[model samples]
Target: MAEDNFEAAPGGFIPGPISSGRGGSGSTARTANSNTLLSEQDVALAAPQADAVPPVIQTLRLQAEATTGVTRGSVSGGTTTTTPVVVSLANASTSDRPNADAADGDAYVDFGGLNGNFNAGSGEYLQWSFAVPAAGTYDLAFGYAFFSASATNRPMRLEVNGKIWDRLFDFTNTGANTTYSEAVTRVYLEAGTQTVRLTATGFSGPNLDYLEIRSADPHRIVIQAEDLLPAATNTTATTVNREITLPFLNGKTPAETFRVGAEGDAYLDWGSEANTLDIPVTATVAGTYSVTITYANGGTTGRPLTLTYLDGTAIGTFALAPTTAPTAYPAFYGDLVPAVRPADGSDAGDVPDQSGWEGWTKSTLTVNVTLNAGTTVLRLSGAGGAQHRQVRVRAGGGVQARAGRPIRHHARQSHGGREPVRRRDRPCHRHRRRFRCAHHRGLRGCEPQHPLRGR
Candidate 1:
């Protein structure tokens, strides 16, 4: 089962502002739907506070209904609106549909509804003015729900202080509208009152709960699968942002799975040897760090993979273990034991289904890597078959080596490459032959004469 506490977006937590095509009902019926969106609260909105001599502010939350000012129609002649309708989580029973759950408080703003349960149309918008304590880049997120019948990719335009930040800010399917997910974007705010607005583009926007502002962590960087450099990507790699339905329990019933807990709810399906991902990353600290990758490998065995720097320095080589069995459901769902289906004698709906890609799972593995401070590209290559979501690099104690040995300081070579002047445990390959360096008085290995010459 995917960890219920999993909250990081698949495309790193702060994937700038999103603009994409990813392809949403009524009200009692609208009320029930909104209530359902509340129950599946995937992330905890309560920010953790570190104890200190003085209490420090952890997160600043602005409720949509309380803080937002609504406006409709043309900006020049739009009428000042009243407080938006705030919906509360419904009390549900075992027989009722999922009850609504709120991340911060009890109620959320009904951005997609008006009057009562009636559907809202385009041109309606909600704006909020909040004060920032400091001037810096912060992670901005919306706790929202969108469960509709006709609309899917309900687009919104974000304007900061009347300046358009993103014209097509995408709010992808959060599986069930009742299932609330945090959609994050990065923004630079000066320490003062800043106005932020979200207006529907073509369709009604998602039901919003609140807007959260938090400090960004420079030591950690997350790269979503869709954010992989297109110029550096292989043509064979395919990116998807939708729900997948597959057979379960001997094909008796079909299961619908979304990239739950994923940023943008998307993943990259590895196609072939040509499918390589070049991830752009910025390291705040230059040192050895650990990279935790969220990926799904459905093969029977592990898939071999190699991580390297853009210049071809090997970070590490390892295999990603399979996240699930190849079977569609039940039999293919590994050792999961759930209630049997009363009619078919198969596993009940309690069994976790494969969520994304053909065999996608929200599993993660951490590997150590050495990175230089500043912007750089990390490359992933090897035999294909694993679906990847997010790669999170965090500063900490980890391995520091280019190949399989520790990196040692040495004088710069005439070729501009810094040779590793460390003693080799075993004989070095011809391309990385060992030599006694006179300048450093230590063992050093020279780079291969040709880029493709070394083994």
Candidate 2:
């Protein structure tokens, strides 16, 4: 038989021996969750911020004549006889009186809908592309010239990322020799590379001057410890498989830890003396702010630490005071509930209030450190003990990360039951519906001595 090429679809590949509901040589096979969310893998846990600023902005301004970031049609918006030409405001001639930024030789003329009949589907007429610093809503504004001689209720369709913008309006000729940005449209955009397309319709639109894409007022972004991209404790995970992760636990019952996690469902850990955690953080703006490290120290002595190489460069060391209990505190349930036990445990119940767990002698620690825009790290010596759950970074802090966000650190199942079965085995708490490892049932690519797996 000729060999066939096998490939996974955008929805995803569901590998299974079960096949479909039926069986046989000609029987149909089974596929699970066939409706694939192609973009789910790309979605990041947006560190939400308070909508404070009236209209704080990160603007990307593009000059029309600069043809690199744009796609175009055969003609620009104006009269066809005008040659869809590039006008220099320096021209003292009174033909196409350029205004605003245009008055200074910074506008496109005789292009787009010069004759009022724009080719709607051609290259989106004109598009300006720029990278969005972060994902959020933004206002789209433009600088262009308008004149009554070439005007006929000139309607222009503005689009961001191909979607027609509701801010479409007619650039009624403002009697040649004038620029208008009186119309401002708002649209939501995603982070990363994006495009703002302009299409002329219903009439010839104004000659282009410049395109401005400005993000809403600046707000705080929270980088939760739970959202770090999955990986081996020290190395980046390259493939989509069981992450070489440390122990993870979360939730109300059956999985209780007095060490209250960020919000509630994020209780991940790392205590090895020498290991690395590559945290993913997208700071919308570049500025200095107090970064707080949230972790639990169930021990009585301090955990030695060193601050080194954030985002890659080496740095000096800083020590944090040990988080120790003021006095001896007895375990709530006689030390049965891991190092951290619920503050309130009902031993009488079959499951005991796994909802709450804290170390009888444990305490939460918050260390405030200064971090610049990108690149930061925390080094550990593991001298006393190093166990942390989360880290919170913010500037005008008010709200914390909302509870129940997808967690990044995960536990790969172990075939041989050697490690703590309590947190790792609870299937309910580990798998994420959006994106997950198919080998989670029987984790692969893991060594026998993997820190969070086999004994």
Candidate 3:
């Protein structure tokens, strides 16, 4: 019998059965030839093309198998099965996954077996990519779950073009199976493809799952109070009040007028007047007054308005203006009093005398008369004893008087053979030699002469 030998080709080795040391039979030779033929065919198929490049495999797919509760690259000789997760990219600009080359069905690569304890503590995460359609604002949102752990500190962040868009979730000491959600405002995305990634950082426990993206719009302003009038100041004594025009007559404009009537005892009278021009004024005392006009865009714009008084007299018209918003034309007024001060000495009669002497009562009056420094005379009268009344005089300081006592001299018929004499205390005593007493027709001719008879 002849022996059969087979040589392996450069592409793959050919399998052959063990033979006895003696020569083989016809069946063994045929089997050896068959192996050799198959090897040769494989080598020919693998040879380089005219371009000197090996043939390219268009698609490649692989599935993970579970063994002993663990999935590995190597598997034992046993039956293996896998489920397919199909993913289709429509407007998607980018993606990050294994076996992305597979087109459909079981050709898709399987992500290795996921354990039940995947979360922050495991420091594990899955990432994906997306493309921005255009250069405009867009809103983005993300959702995922983490596993429970003693210190599950899982946090997720979003990045666009390698820049952190936002941090989605941050949790410490999370339970075994918890889910978290994150949302962000509308951001400006530039034109062209953008690399959007969802990263799980600070997670020390387990794995994360599931992420998605979508679109949104910007905000607007609808209400404004800029047209409302402000407060005005008045310097007049007369009550001159005005009304403010409603910038928005449709009633959508929110405005309030705070007028402190006039300073002293003044009050804001907001009756049923629709505008500032229509407000009626009651009588006010003569003085400088101020009216403060306060207006608002309600609570919307929160802008303050000012009420201004025009130039000239204090009794001019008032206008409403705002730092921002539409201008308003309201009523105005002028200062009540003229600015001039009255002149002094205008009326001589009105002037008061600053210098004058004051008088005392006559009952408290005293008289004082002094002779030369060497002599003085003091007189006492109205009380005396004599034939008639006589004035007494006192002298002091080296002066003397002829009459020491009270004396009287009068003319009368002789009594007891005494001759009639003139009374020295008579009113005519000083001129005794000038005149004599007259006799009345009676029993006695002349009695004691009295000073009361004359004068």
lDDT of 3 at 23: 19
Residue 224 displacement (Å), model 3: 24
Tell me the tens digit of each residue's lDDT in model 1 across 315-371. 776577766432222121222123312122345644344322333334333556666
Prediction 1 global C-alpha lDDT:
0.47
lDDT of 3: 0.23
Better of 1 and 3 by TM-score: 1
Candidate number achieving the greatest TM-score relative to the actual structure: 1
TM-scores of all candidate predictions against the true structure: 0.40, 0.32, 0.21
RMSD vs true structure, all candidates: 21.0, 27.8, 64.4
lDDT for position 122 in model 1: 43
Report the number of backbone clashes for model 3: 45
Q: What is the lDDT of residue 119 in candidate 1?
A: 33
Q: Arrange candidates by lDDT, highest first: which order?
A: 1, 2, 3
Sequence-dependent TM-score of model 3:
0.21
